[model samples]
Target chain A: MAQRTVLFVLFDQVQSLDVTGPVEVFAGAERHTPGTYRIGTASLDGAPVRTSSGLTVVPDRSLADVPDPDTLVVPGGQGTRSPDPRLTDWLRAHGPHVRRLVSVCTGAALLAGAGLLDGRRATTHWAYCDRLAREYPAVDVDPDPIYVRDGHVATSAGVTSGIDLALALVEEDLGRDTALTIARHLVVFLRRPGNQAQFSAQLAAQTARREPLRELQRWITEHPGADLGVETLAARAGLSPRHFARAFRAETGTTPGRYVDRIRLEHARRLLEDTGDGVEQVSRASGYGTPEGMRRAFVKALGTSPAEYRRRFRPAPAH
Target chain B: MAQRTVLFVLFDQVQSLDVTGPVEVFAGAERHTPGTYRIGTASLDGAPVRTSSGLTVVPDRSLADVPDPDTLVVPGGQGTRSPDPRLTDWLRAHGPHVRRLVSVCTGAALLAGAGLLDGRRATTHWAYCDRLAREYPAVDVDPDPIYVRDGHVATSAGVTSGIDLALALVEEDLGRDTALTIARHLVVFLRRPGNQAQFSAQLAAQTARREPLRELQRWITEHPGADLGVETLAARAGLSPRHFARAFRAETGTTPGRYVDRIRLEHARRLLEDTGDGVEQVSRASGYGTPEGMRRAFVKALGTSPAEYRRRFRPAPAH
Candidate 1:
């Protein structure tokens, strides 16, 4: 395969991690498979840019000096909050031409401002998701997955998720074995622990504003093994089941049953990862009456049997 | 409580993440609880140090300008392999006087060379652990844990373990709640992981150089659910039970029974983290006869029941 030129764009106040995590992963891959990646960093002008954490980065080349690179990575930080028009103007003009256009964290904001992500399903740091959606009505901002790849334009969530997205790109280019090797070298999961596909977005999406409902939500999360049927929860909350379900949906954006399912799955997944517990015990603890119930949930939601899921996602003992 | 001042020593060729990961965590904490931690970065002469990744970092002040900091942090990279004598000399003179002394990645090498870790238990990047032990026999290097706390001086493994160690310090100084809040803001785990105490060290420690034995080791790791009795394994290896047991111990340094236990525990933990499988199924799949058997192993090894372990280690549905 021919070498791919990967250029990282540097700006003032960029979060250093948004740059290093991916850079390090790709760099590790390059070390293992030399001539696969030719990585470089550039700024709008050939000057030093200070990271949000107060580290200053001196760029290798000017943005104008390098044109139409295979991959252009834009990292986000405070600088993206109020960016230079020249930078966005540059992105607006050159983004579509690049083979791969990527953004880390709030760098999505810059891309949206430049119309690169217009009508694209994208994601950013969870904290900034709502703002990105609100500000750029044309951009489909997903606040859930660690990263999103909409065609050739890809975006990732806060800080470390950049590492995840970068690994995905590497895996695409060099296959799973190469990506896995680099991840092991970095001591990070090739895929982070747990099912990112059925990520905890539903439960993290909303919390009831009412104090009693909020307390109930916490209770449900904390005690996944407890009887979480609508009637039992309704009695505890001093409301009729019908009334409780309505209030929960109105306040939290999901029905009580759905929320409970999400929590139980999360609980079971944690047990599998952290403990040497049996599937039956994990199922019971996660409120599944039978092991089969948990298996069905795992298959339906995550598209893998519980055992296979564990095998795939869990760290292969440090060796 | 008086605000503790944390000073990070920066040097040329330092890993940027080694510096930023901890800085971002502390910076997030400061954002939440103002006046709690005053964090700064400095170099021997406050010059702009270029990181191994080629990013330039300008230190906040000169090392001579800051004396007797409450906490001193030395981050590692390629730079630590051949450090300036002035930096090591400074650390040797000033390390003990600080309330807390910390090292990340290969930074421990510098500390060990300076005699700061001469009689203290410590750790560094996993790949470097053996080298660190071989080079500095006086430094009681324990390579198992992600991070080690030897009195007031703490050392951590690799790039990301620094984040884990930093969070531990924040938890010690502030509280679980404060540290947890910062972690959530940064999209990282507060405690990071399931029984980090029962980390997969045994499996990581040795891989038999002999091809057949190495293949057997891989088999044991991959098929934790298999019947792995000495007789069964001996049959698979085409040897008598006694001979197989002896050869396995000699080659792997650990008995087959011990290796199997480690692999089983690791497999069970992965299921708990990634799947919605029930505990009984998880136990059976992990080759434990019953949920009770799995529970016993978990308690003996991780000191937590399966249900409790899942609760403690699982990510709270991400809100």
Candidate 2:
């Protein structure tokens, strides 16, 4: 088989992993299937490109000198916030010719700016998702998935999800067995399904706004065993339950029930990590009616069981 | 709280992700808890250190200028094969003062070469595990775990596992909740428990050596539905079942039964990825008599069920 050329575009201030993570996966794929992928990097002038972390990358070729690539990778970083028009023009000119076009993190912004992702479902770093959506209304930005692949263009959520996206590409080109092998070699999860949410309950909690709602949130967090139903929370907020639910959802972007559940789960997680309490006791203390109820909540929220969560997150005994 | 200083030792030819993955985790931790971890990079001369992938990182300070760090990170790549004496000397001089000493990939070689890992349980990248063990007999090298923590010293296997090690550090310093939040923001698995082996069934199959055993392995792979018992495999290899089992283990470092099981699981995984087969059909085709048996094997080997594996690895139909 002819070697598939994978050309990674290097630009000023690119996130180091946004380039390296996917590149490593492709390199691993080449190792698994010798002579399958010919990896290279290109820059505007073939000079060293400085990364966001003050790292500099030497590109293999200047954009003008490089041959058409089978796969074109554009990584995101602080650079993507204000991309050089030369780079965007290069992508606009060359992106459609590539068999596959991929963006890691805020690289989606560059692609969208280049008109490559217009009207396409895409994603970027969770923190930047709203900005991406607001900036590029033509692009359907879905922030949940680790990656979003629409047609031949793909976009990953953040830095490390680039590896997941590249693994999926390897799976498409080689096979699942090969992808799984590479994933194992990397010691990452075999595959993080693309649709998995990018934000955690804690992250959601951290985004709480409105003093009344924030105070209610803090109260709920501190008193997980308290009756945190909408009626009680609404009363605490000095509003009717219906009004509080709407106001909470509008301000927090989550329903009252979801907010309470997340708070309870966060409390339960802390109990699991800091204390040696068993599942039933912890569940009850966290306001879950039973161990089964808490287990369901854990699985629904974290895709892990209460026991597994505790096993994974529980603090090790100090020596 | 006094901010903990994490000094990442940048060297020529360092794998870019090996530095960025952990640095990002620490940076995320700082975001979660401001003034918690102060991250910086240092090089022997405090110059721009070129990484293995032709990326160069500008270090924050030289060894002479930087204060004693709470944590010191050494990353590895091509440069580790023959580390510069200047780097090793610096490590030897300063390593003991660091509260936590860490290595990613073959950076363990530098640690071991510096005599920092003498008589210590350590690990490196799987590909370099044997050499690490052979070269440093005093250092007990176990390559299975994603990251191995021995006292204040920690070493992670391969490049990406650096994030896992860093997350473990964050969990230890802050809490599991903080680590999980960082992991979620990064779009990586919440926590890959440290002990997870860095090899998959497909990786094992690819490592097969010796002609007769290789042929038998090929036959087993081709015929996953066939009875791949020791007796059948031995007949094919023209040896007694017991002798064949012993020789197989000697050559492959795994028992015949385990090898067959791995091959079957690999086949099952392929089916899950490629075909829209039900769990029962895939189970039967992969020589697992029942779906329950297949489920058990999948859970044991991959920590996921067939359905979940399919959901993760299966390609989405074209829109």
A237 Cα displacement, candidate 2 (Å): 8.1
Could you give candidate 2's per-residue lDDT for residues A57-127 as a string of tens digits? 56777998998899999998888888889988999999999999999999999999999999899999887
Name the regions of candidate 1 deviating beyond 4 angstroms. A195-319, B194-319
Task: Note the Cα lDDT for every prediction shown.
Answer: 0.81, 0.81
In the range B155-197, model 2's lDDT, one tens digit per residue, is 9888888988898899888987788878777776655543444
What local lDDT does model 1 show for residue B273?
57
Total clashes for model 1: 32
Task: In model 1, state the lDDT of residue B279.
Answer: 95
The candidate that achieves the highest TM-score relative to the unseen native structure: 2
Worst 10 residues of 2 chain A by lDDT: A193-202
lDDT (Cα, tens digit) per residue for candidate 1, span B57-98:
678889999968898999999899999999999999999899
